[model samples]
Structures are given as structure tokens and as C-alpha cells.
Target: MNTSDLKTKIQNLYQDILINLDIEKIDDYFAENYVQETDHDTLNLNEFKDHLQKLKDVVKSLSIEKFNDMLIDEQQRSIFLRYDVAVEKVDNSMGNIEVYAIFKFNEVGKVISCRELSKAYHEELEGLANI
Candidate 1:
């Protein structure tokens, strides 16, 4: 797909799926055979769905701060995004994080897989001064 098409899909995944927790959106954007990769390991579509469900259960609410950058390789049908994520912590505190992700789409314009890296921090930085 084209850059704008890819961007729209990513935005819909974030806005309609992740944020709203709309499982139905998954049907449209994510292939039923989709998978996810992380530094730790890979998860199949069902596993990934379960993972997101668990997070939704715990996080209560979550949001992406912004999408700072995006690159799409039409030939590979891949899209990369650098984004800032902000969320309400489990303890009711606030947290901000940065994430970079690769979204792999099928020839049919459905996301077939994804891989991501994220960096997160809390108040520990300030405490380190006393250490």
C-alpha cells in the first residue's frame, strides 16, 4: 500500500483498536494469522490478542502521546513508526514512554505482523542523584 494508506491503518490500529480496545477492528486491519515479535520472543495472533487483553485489563486506560516519525516501504509492505506513549500507571501515577515499531502488512493491506521496542522510565532518574 501507499504511505498514506499505511499511516491510516496505523492510526486506526491505535485509535480504534488499542485505545478503544475494539477487537472488531482487528478483523479489518490484522490478519487472523498475524504474529508479533519482540526482543524476548514471537507471539502468534491469538497469543498477541491475549497479551493485549491482559494489558487492557491492567492498564485501565492508555494513549499514545504522538507519532513523531514514520517510514513506509511499499515493496516490503512494512511501516515503521517512532512514537511517544503516555499512560496512567497502575498505581494512578502518570508515565511516558518512547516506542519504535515495525508493522508488516500483507499484500492485501492487512497487518500480518509487528515488532516493537520501547523505553520507559519513572522517578528513578531523580533518585539516582542521591545514590
Candidate 2:
């Protein structure tokens, strides 16, 4: 819809869903028809939930290390964002990943699609990132 609304949604996604490990809240941010394309694989809404579950199981903490970019297209309700992610694994090992993602939103403002690329430069993150 609007840039501010989109920004709020993105912030909530990281703070309330990913950082909090609240899988149930995902529906609030993502559409039922959600699909994500990643370098490795494609995931539907159900698969995305499973992926989050796996992350919840293995990740002790998650934080945004750096926010590189966020560009929104108001006409299309789409955005391109790049950020660095820092995570503490269940084993207490630390890792960092750089992620670039494109997200498309539905009329009601739920995320309908996402295509993402992520890479870990450090060994500590390589294994944890697979989940």
C-alpha cells in the first residue's frame, strides 16, 4: 500500500515473528498463498512454516547486524531489501549472513511472494543457515 505501512510490516516480521520465534504470527504477515523462491529451493506457505520451525529449533537468537538497503515501489506494493543477519545457534555458536530479498504484497498487505538470496561468510553460520 504505502511505504510507511510496508516498513512497519517488515519491522514486525523481524521483531515479532523471526526474533520471537512465533510461528503462529506468520499468518498475520504472510498470505495463505505465499511462495518464496530461494537460491536453493522454492517454498510454499506450509513449507515456509516448516522452515521457520526448523530455525526456531536451532537458533537461539537472531539480530539484524546491518541494514544495507530498502527500496519500495508503491505502485506495485513490492520492495527490495538487503540486510545482514547475525544469529546465535543452539550450540551457542555465532554466525553472520548477508541476505537480499524481494517481496510482493497483496491488496490487503499480506506478503504474497518472496524471492531471496542469502550467504554466510563464516563457517559457524554455514551449517545453521541450511535450516
TM-score of each: 0.84, 0.93
Q: Tell how far residue 128 is off in model 1, in angstroms.
A: 23
Taking the tens digit of each residue's C-alpha lDDT, what string does model 2 give over 1-131? 79999888887887887679799899999999999887668899998899889998888999885569999998999989999888888999887888899999999999999998889877878745446
Q: Of the candidates shown, which would achieve the greatest lDDT relative to the real structure? A: 2
Residue 54 of model 1, lDDT score:
64
User: How many residue pairs collide in each prediction?
Assistant: 0, 0
Question: TM-score of predicted model 2?
Answer: 0.93
Q: What's the CA RMSD for each of the models?
A: 5.6, 1.3
lDDT of 1 at 131: 14
Any idea what lDDT model 2 has? 0.85
TM-score of 1: 0.84
